[model samples]
Target: MTQTGWTAGRSARALASLALCASVVTACGSASAAGRPVVLSYYNEPDSSPATQDAANACSAASHGAYRIVYNKLPSAADLQRQQLVRRLAAHDSSIDIMGLDVTWEAEFSEAGWILPWTGSEAQQVEADTLPGPLQTAMWNGKLVAVPQSSNTELLWYRSDLVPNPPATWGQMIADAVQLAKEGKPHYIEIQGAQYEGLTVWFNSLVASAGGSILNANSTAPSMGAPALKAMQIMSQLAHSPAADPSLSVQQEDQNRLAMEGGTAAFEINYPFVYPSMKSDNPALFKNFKWTTYPQVSTSLPLHSTLGGIDLTVSSYSKHAALARQAVLCLRDPANQLEAAVKGGLPPTLTSLYQNPAPEFVAMYPFYKDILQQLTTAAVRPKTPEYQAVSIYISHTLSPPGSISPASNLSSLTGQIRDALDQKGLIP
Candidate 1:
């Protein structure tokens, strides 16, 4: 029940004076939301857990009747959520006042001018004391377009009962898994291998960890050179080895988590959510469930595990933009961020939360030290206005990892991305 202790910031103070009259003063009680407290519709992915609704409730109470944040749950899929938000925003609909955006959507939404960027003191407040990696995702063309609500990064989860020491390098991991396979033990290495956003994340991590990026600094075209080839070689090696899951081409995060918990996998690359799930579903296996830093592509190079999570933004078309912004601040404040972290398994974006975690937080995240270390070097996916299109191109080229010809596949990817950037390639 302890607080995460992040300052509520200038946005909360500025918003307090508007409690008497709603931000939409003239439109108050004019339409479907006829009441003293203006209804702020918050569209986000469905969270069966109390994290989302609870944050909404806390923020509404803190508003002192200035606004009521109604949680409108969207589809669970990332692409579907983006589609819904894009369609509504394109129509200039005011129904969606706030949205929970995927980290990768900041650039696209900001470029489209669908979401308002936080400026002045509010922007300073949001940026302060936040983890640099998560904060990086909220910036677009030098504007803080969104506030990071929570963040996530993958780790190498292994069974300690079988392996005495965790593999530090990808080559070592594959060699270990292959040997276990020969001994007829649980040796499958689980990862996100499906032709979707997960595949893009995997490829991005590999390239970034090897000191290369999928796109140049400007994110206009492919930068797949030596580092990319190294990443491709690693991906192909795993896919062609005995350590790969039988359903590697079709597996996503949940599938990878399930394989690890099903006792058929000796290793898994996934997020911390798998920690609690394993404890609940298979206590015996959970006893041996342990985690380490993500296996790296090179011993000399630092890992750049892909970052994932939700960010909160005020819709540009909202009638009550000020109130929406203020409520968003409260929704992601320390108290609520801690709630989401301790209960929902989502990590807080604030640096202090990891530096000085409370008892409840520590109980849920005993490995916070490792997580923080990784977060310090975490990398975001390709930052571009055409991120979705680029993701599609990268995912399709690297799908069905078992068939990857690193050199050939990389060349095809380079050409597709170039044409797409010049508007000569189709999205589908």
Candidate 2:
């Protein structure tokens, strides 16, 4: 595998700074030196329920007085969570024992040595338990850098009562949507077209569904070619079509969901949370809703849903690395994952959970099989330390999708992606 010079230089600088911080704190020698119990601080984005806290409490009790787990909540936004963690880790804050990481962050965090690597029996167990796509997200440069705790993927949500059979391809969906619009029902399709992470996700899935990727196999350069152009062409056409939501350029996932629930759109692509949320907010609409695998870009190609969710990692700067690892393992236990799914609406990474879902998850059993299948086939965005830059380039360049022309913009898009990967024009 080839390493980028930019990443290497940054990693060296980060390590040097960490060394200085370590000297001041005696390298955070131990979690505890005296008889007092060691405290392990876990930092993660806040969850809606106390499932994570409950698991931490259970693990602490199970540790037999060895350590106590302290929860530190980060901002809800993924970017903010990453920013906060990066600042602390760069400073060598040993208090960050464990961290809840976004799946896309595994590559960056592992490459920069901000998180610990998993090996041996533990690695084998995690690999064996997690579904393939989610498991792959925790790996970086051929090593397991984290453990998949919960996993998510997009699904094609449709008004089943109106259209009994969902379309199999994007072309078909668009055609049906156009027909619906002509019938005086506008906004037939709801999608995340805003210039944000959601747009990147949508593009990733579209490219993958067309049997292409944003980067080559090694992930060191841009690989957006014909397939990518085709994906963009489809997106452009949809945005300019009569069936599109007028606010397409500004629509986020929540707005799309609300549009669908408000009886404005006939179809949407969103995460599983919408299922339960709709069930609670509008039972009548929820009853009419149904979901299936994300629509394929072509009839011959299989659909590729975009992956999302969290991973658990032991912070490389943690003083209590060993105990933190144990705590992470406990927190990711299948039982705890099941509880998180039941109470927090987070999907379990464990394959067994899909085979035999817990009672709490049974309420959505109608969609579980399809959800699990989509998770297994999900496509991940570029796994690079420069992913933030890449995402920004793609989202910004393709904003107000109607303005994009595959024929004229493909080369420019590829150039921009390469620039981002090379750290050119980066904000630092």
Candidate 3:
């Protein structure tokens, strides 16, 4: 687990952000006039899955005039969404009663005192039947700051026609790709190698699978020693191979999906969304597409793919806290989660949803078993308020995977992370 202590006080950047927030915060109506349903403004990313909107509608109706859960859609990009919420929360805007926070944002929002911690029976209710990985991300400093809504992890997707069996380890996968390349076949291994959070997720997954972590136990310094270096060497090896994508350094998840669908690649490490996308966009290729657990760094160690998801949180600035909290619980109820899984391709956070899942869910996620197993042991990124800066620095050092010089780059990365943690680094 990553440490998320925030007692060192705000950095200059945070202070400047707060100052900016004070300057441009907008005004909105009160929670309610009186006797009117309290307008619980639920701010979230656009509802890619109908489940999000369905939950909001369902909860509002269930409130029975107590509150109306208004679905306020934010921008698509994660960073853009965070910027909007942070500015509003910093200025103590009461308009936002509930927020759908990205898992990484939970620690930052909680540490900044922008989100309320769940306690008493509410906390227990949130904890009940939640999968460990998603639930872990919903917490900060040993407190539940949010409720897990939807969760996701990557699976090793492959062209079954190209490879009768999936590779169990990274080395084996690379070797198989190389052999296929020699035969003039579509052999590229698709992965997220772009200089962004995706790159951080990639490296974090590799390090964890190699039995190491990016930060020390306390999250104050680097803990990436030999294991991280070994992980880096594998990245370098893949980058140098002919089986690697030529645009590897620039590829993100969508690009990887496109590459595989375009038939230039035989393998992909991506989320469940690709399964549905492939079926819709390329039926022929989708016919041979198969998935398995994420590749291992070592046969001796268990695979640990990084976790991705959203959490439902109540804003500290909300005037309708009581209503918002009630809505949060309802929004993540099993029915809504199932809809999100079957319709939106998102995995549910509730563990019970996976055991003998709905037939519709099974149809969408034939590899649900792999997803459940990997998520049970999924690795979270560093849990400090400085996670964004740390990710920027690490990605800066590791971008263009082919350029990775294991030993020296590892040392340089260690120094950069330390600077980021100390709040003195310039990532760019």
Q: Per-model C-alpha lDDT, please? A: 0.89, 0.86, 0.89
Would you list the clashing residue pairs of candidate 2?
none
Q: Which run of 10 residues does model 2 get worst, by summed lDDT? A: 27-36
- What does candidate 2's lDDT look like per residue over 1-428, in tens digits? 22377479658856875676577676444422442468898988797799988888888888888888877889999999999999988998877999999989988898888987899988888898789889889989899999999888888899877778899999989998988877776446889999899999999999998899999988889998888999999999898888789899999989998888888889998888888878888899888888888899988888788899999999898988988888888989988888888888788899999887876678755678887888898898799988988888889888888889887778887988898888887532
- Candidate 2 TM-score over all chains jointly: 0.90
lDDT of 2 at 137: 91
Candidate 1 lDDT trough over 10 residues, lowest sum: 1-10
Error of 1 at 376 (Å): 1.8
C-alpha root-mean-square deviation, each candidate: 7.0, 9.7, 10.6
Instruction: Give the poorly placed runs of model 2, Cα more than 4 Å off.
Output: 1-35
lDDT of 3 by residue, 293-333 (tens): 99999899988899999999999988878878998999899
> On a 0 to 100 scale, what is the lDDT of residue 235 in model 2?
95
After the best TM-score superposition of candidate 1, give how far the Cα of residue 205 lies from its true spot, in angstroms. Answer: 0.3
